[model samples]
Target: MAIRRGRGVAAINYPTGMNLGGDPTQALVHSTPTGNFMVTLSSVDLGQGMKQIMAQICAETIGVPTDRVVVDTADTDTGPHCMGTFASRGTHRAGNAVIQAAKEARQVMLEVAAEELEVNASDLETDGQGNILVKGAPQKSISIFDVALSAHFKRGRSISGRGMFLIPRSYPEKETGAMKPSTCYAHACTVAEVEVDDETGEVTVLTVKNVFEIGRALNPKMVEQQLVGGSWMGISHALYETTEPYYPNRDHGGTDFNQYLMPGPGDLAETEIIVLERPSGDGPYGAKGPGEMCANPQIPAVANAVFDAVGVRIDTLPITPERILRALKAQAN
Candidate 1:
């Protein structure tokens, strides 16, 4: 994972920008008396739940439950360096890699199966659910478990599996500063409704309705949590939070959290959410990043809500009472 923010080390405020990430191929194998098989990566998942995805894929590759599958992240010391997880790229890249690894491991299993049953690997099938069946004889076939045991005890061979994904992207050839090509992109939209006091410029968010096009809903619960968390953070970032905007005239500072007010418990209002499901192409399992979409609409939505309440619109962020009063006076004239 490579994080190349545009802001310099000395820069105080870094504007929002795109984040990129990648992955490497993961490979593992084990040899038994009967056969050798391997396991591969679907991708690296941390608390975000990529591990679960891998477990499922791994179990399928080895013909076991997700719980039964063992996983190991590609290590730089003993294993190849997998791209560190970031930019929400784990499932897509790593999932593909895991597929590759599983295929390699399956070859060994099929060979062993052919030897035991006296049939070609093509004549045998290992369903993702752990059942292994011969093409013409279901009753004559055995389980992947039986096959694994045979390879371990009888053949005196090993079973191994390997998989990886090298998510492709273009890098700048010259030293000239240019945006790198991104492999995946996520997009969304949200709407909000509210009211404001023209005199006090106090804005009460009536109902914040969020409509977003998630690439694909991987986990509805997790997606909702992302929206909730992001919306809350957006509220603070756009409505109440204040930071000093140093200028040439006032090179020094002001607008500390204590001095610069924000929307607290009393200032808050009702929040409603609506999701617009749209499948994004580059996402994993049709899952786009929902972490920042709600945030994008927060400031604009709150500003519009304030206008509906007080019949005055404040273009700037925060939409403070002072600004509202000033806009109301100007409009009244």
Candidate 2:
């Protein structure tokens, strides 16, 4: 038999934030005398660029450049309380907290700058380059560093603020199980193209095309990287990874990478991603988390593609050749 090619598509909706006590997260923001700002949080990054995303959120909220915002995360003993980083809550929860704290700190900085310039705080605006200027009179401006020095040395005020965000938990109707568990949901659709060898039952993925409505893209590059990595992880799980070769009689299982099988770069399919921004009401700057949702539709799409290719329904995981061939033989019989 000849090799056959097929395509399949899938769509998924992924929730952001969890339902535990409304999934609260806190942030602390303060300005240093050197004019830099720091945001402290207990949420861990876990290689998902939490620090960079939070810094972008804080800088945008406080009207400063991202470089001026430093994110200090993962120090539980020193940082404020946070729900652990998982379930796609890092950006939405922590970013909102930073927004609240940075807003307050920015207000304080404006007031201090107003006093120094003999102007009303409402008439002052920051240039986002460490400078505060009188609105409509850009020529009359003061460096944020000078204002910070005056705040600490002359005004005896600390430019610090604290903030916390908690989504209100809702009681689900016992009969319907309907309740708001997440503040926002990210959506994605994926289409996978694959070719299957009839004789060998081997599948080769040719391409994966994805479109995501992730509320916002605080860091487009990071979003792209996540999609690339997550797609591959999905591929590995769908076709190459399994721990229990024999369930009741476990074998070939161990605690090392050598014992595990996973797809590498050679297995990656060509990917095309389209990001759509439909700002969420609850997220900071309308940014719904993107890390977890990247892989949501990939596995199903690949599985569907396999079915389309071979006209057989092999439901088990890894879709090993033995299973495919067995399904084919049954179909023929």
Candidate 3:
């Protein structure tokens, strides 16, 4: 038998954050004596660049340069309260909290700048270049560094703010049972192309093209990396990764990495990603979570591709050659 090529597609709509009794997150924004801003949170980064996204949000909200902002993911003992980072809620929930806190701190900074410049705080605005200037008067300005020094020594005031974001829980309607489970939804579609050998029962993935609507891409490069890496994980789950060889019988299972099966770099497929931005109303700066959704569609897509190639449906994960040959043999009987 010869190898047969096939293509299949899958799509999904993923929720941004859980809407459980106001899943809440808190943030604290405070300016240092050296004019740098600090954002303290209890949410862990988990290597997903949460710290960088929070820093960008805080810096933007406070009208400061991103480099001047630092994010500290301190533990619950030192940082503010946070409902642990899950359900892809880090960016949407914590980001909103950081925005609120940064706004309050920025207000105090403007007030301090107003006092130093002898102008109304309402008329003052930050240039995002470490300077606060009067509207329409570029020459009349005060540096954020001087303002911070004055606030600490001369004014004897601490520039700090606290904020928390909570989405009120929605109750199901008594009659229709309608309820809002999430604040927003992110969408994605993936098309996987593969070749399957009818005789050998082997499958080779050729390419995976994905399109995602993630509300907004705050950091395009990071988004690309996450999506590409996630697609690889999806491919692994679809064709290679497995620990339970004899299911329903727990006797035979992979106990170590050497015994486990997974795809290496040579097994990776050619991946292409296209990002679409549809800003959410309540999302922080129109940004939503793109956490695990990137790895979802590829599973079903690959499964469907195998069916199209061999005319046999394989429902189990890590569709091994033995399973494919069994399906083919059963079909031939």
Candidate 4:
């Protein structure tokens, strides 16, 4: 089965001031400065390739490179008012919203370029590296750099953009929104192989192969990293990471590093991550959300793999040997 976590993951990231159940999902983002055609955003991409994904989205929309675009996610006081980092909504929700806003900001500059080049804004082309070429007259061109300078010096308007959007914008009759359209939906499936010692009742994941469908892999390196890390996280959730709430099953409380037993690098199996290529019409540079989507279906995959290996069904999660043995005994009966 596919990992269907888009809405659930989207809901968890909102802060206390924002209501997940409320109409619109919001972003509290702030742009730093425009060195050239570059702009910044307030999504601190820890490791899920969100930074590169968002940068690609911006560059494609506003006509710049991955390098010409910058993002500043530090400092909560200054950044856009956003739901704190939890659900992997960074690139999907925030990326599209900001890209839409940046396109608005670049509209003014594009108009300036068109006027200077003596052509319609739609007729001009942005080669995505600061170069704007007028149709049929490449010589008659303008750099976004010059446009920025002119916008600042000649027009006397700050070349910056700010925007806010709430996902699933469902509300009362006066509501002015709808479910914020998702740019893309990243999808994944995993296959696991495990070994269970019949005598010791211990199981180890022998191998894990994951295939992910991510729209327009902006940066292959970053996408690979996200898939690998996200697969490992799912593996941990399946094998270890126990969420005990007000229960005394093992005479312990919540699962920290000590209580939890996440697999180390040594414990990790031969992980093969396959990236599916599909261009999303709504995504920025065809990028979709990857992290949470990859995590959703993993537990079921691992459980199915265990059943495949032992010829027994372990319904309860965290397939410990004790349960496997109990299943085995019941099967024998």
Candidate 5:
């Protein structure tokens, strides 16, 4: 008939991309007439800042300002082929493809600037400020806008490139079950503190602290927002969300969104996250995927916290009050 507090910790290692018969992604980079670069891909953004990150990657690879790059993921029909975005592969796979395309387009851009400046392409360099200049003599430079105009009207050249990335499938050895399944791994640990009401069997998550090793943070702000929002989703999956209440007999189940159960704003816990960078060689700019792993560790952490608080191990999800009370009653007997 009193409130009890407890803490628990959980750790997990998640894979970045699955090795599904050479998971492949393609990208196309081309310069517009206005000196802007367009990157076309089939990877969906899913509101995870995919477009922003891809644009940043393209701009960095092509030696231009981030604002000058645009990512176009309009649809699969127009864009290049991509193994659908899942298994946290969007950033790692599609980013590599964009880098390849941008590099090729950048080489052509340097060549175009070389032709205009009457210098060898090897002697040219990009200042990343919309200017292509000679390596030693910065004064002998050509603006990207002028270069684009020349390429289109004067040179009759297309500053465009296409690229695709695929990880050749590694078949398992016969002697031992050894094979490469994922491109890279991300690790995370979460500590959850919870308070349980012995009388009502209700659990209140007090705080959740997470530490993640996700290679590199392409966009720090976006990564932080994803981690924070994902923690709330983990909490919801642990103690609130359920599609079927009466399983084994599909007689009673949620029919619509209104019938579904989930936690409200008031039920959210204070969350703290710390990101660690351990760059992966194969990843794009040493950046791995933090997509699904962000919400993984918190589930087991909360379950362990509830067990620590009530001295009862509730294995099922949602951790409803009735289940807790029944466990308590059985323990008493």
Candidate 6:
């Protein structure tokens, strides 16, 4: 009985957004009388830090601090239309829409502030901290809060804007299946190290080293969290998840957690991630989607690692002890 170790690598290019009629998303931005900004969107966050990233983008675009920006993820009834959250399009699609909305709102804000300050609209700049100042004159400035109040009460104007993002459809060539599925692509490479128990045919994944070109991390901490979580999900899918195995006989299947074969937190492997920030031209502030691509290369990397360790190919999933043992026997014969 010996433990064998091996390493394997995989590279993948994942597209962002779907190819269904130029996936579209919408956003709305408005300023309150108190100078705070509000953003409304129909896209759901799903615990992926969507709200935080969107807020940051809105604040930066409108020349306000992050704290002054409020994100309201309203449902379909009140918010604008969205093409759902899959295809890793939330950040790229929704964020861009928010930027557009903020640009419009900022124009309104600057116009109103210019009227009060008696200066040209183009000569005013935001300090990124809720204050609008004159160009080349830091001392001449007005708080956004005051501008908001005047816009509503004295000027009879409302500071609000709307935006929608749509990726134009790329028609496929008649003879070839050449079509752009998404506006941009996020790239990833994963190398996995694993150990195999020759006697029991059990495999243990030790580490996953990853390099990702995510087109800029809107929230780096959130990106790291998704990468770690997605890696585990990939490992679980590659090794333990099965809906209907042994189709003819269903004796081994269970309807609950106890009966299902899945990896627990105890089975998580060490992950080292290197994020390369290459902004996308079409993305908001050079940002791209990073949610779904983290798990893509891990499955293939693990499969190749198993092949390198034991010199046997288990084409099917889970890489179970029985499958390994059977493959070993076939090799011996």
Q: Pick the candidate with the highest lDDT.
A: 5
Residue 131 CA error for candidate 4 (Å)? 2.3
**Against the hidden true structure, what lDDT does model 2 obtain?**
0.87
Q: Clashing residue pairs in candidate 3, if any?
A: none
Show model 6 residue runs off by greater than 4 Å. Answer: 247-254
Per-model clash counts, in order, read 35, 0, 0, 6, 0, 0
Task: Write model 6 residue lDDT over 234-258, tens digit each, in one string.
Answer: 7877777776666567667657898
lDDT winner between candidates 1 and 5: 5
Over 4 Å off, model 1: 1-46, 57-63, 72-80, 156-158, 171-180, 198-202, 240-285, 291-295, 307-333
lDDT of 1 by residue, 1-333 (tens): 121111001001111123344335455645334322334332355565666655555565566556556556544466544565654555555555665666677777777777788888888886666656787788767666667787778775456666555654445657785754555555544455554544456555545555666566666776677677666656665566545433345543344756666566665546665666666565444555555555667666666556555556677666666777788789889
Error of 2 at 317 (Å): 2.1
TM-score of 2: 0.95
Off by over 4 Å in 5: none
Which TM-score value belongs to model 3? 0.95
Candidate 6 whole-model C-alpha lDDT, 0 to 1: 0.89
TM-score of each: 0.65, 0.95, 0.95, 0.77, 0.95, 0.95
Candidate scoring better on TM-score of 1 and 4: 4
Assess candidate 1 and give its TM-score to the true structure: 0.65
Error of 1 at 110 (Å): 3.2
Q: What is residue 254's positional error in candidate 2, in angstroms?
A: 5.6
Q: Candidate 3 regions off by >4 Å?
A: none
* Candidate 3 per-residue C-alpha lDDT over 1-333 given as tens digits, one digit per residue, 9 for 90 to 100: 899998989999999878767789999999999789999999999888999999999988888899999999967787898988888899999999999999999999989989999999999988888899999998999999999999998888778889899988889999999999887888899999999998898889999999999988988899889898888888888887777765877665778877676667778788999999999899999988898888889999999999989888999988888889999999999
lDDT of 3: 0.90
In candidate 2 the C-alpha lDDT for residue 93 amounts to: 89
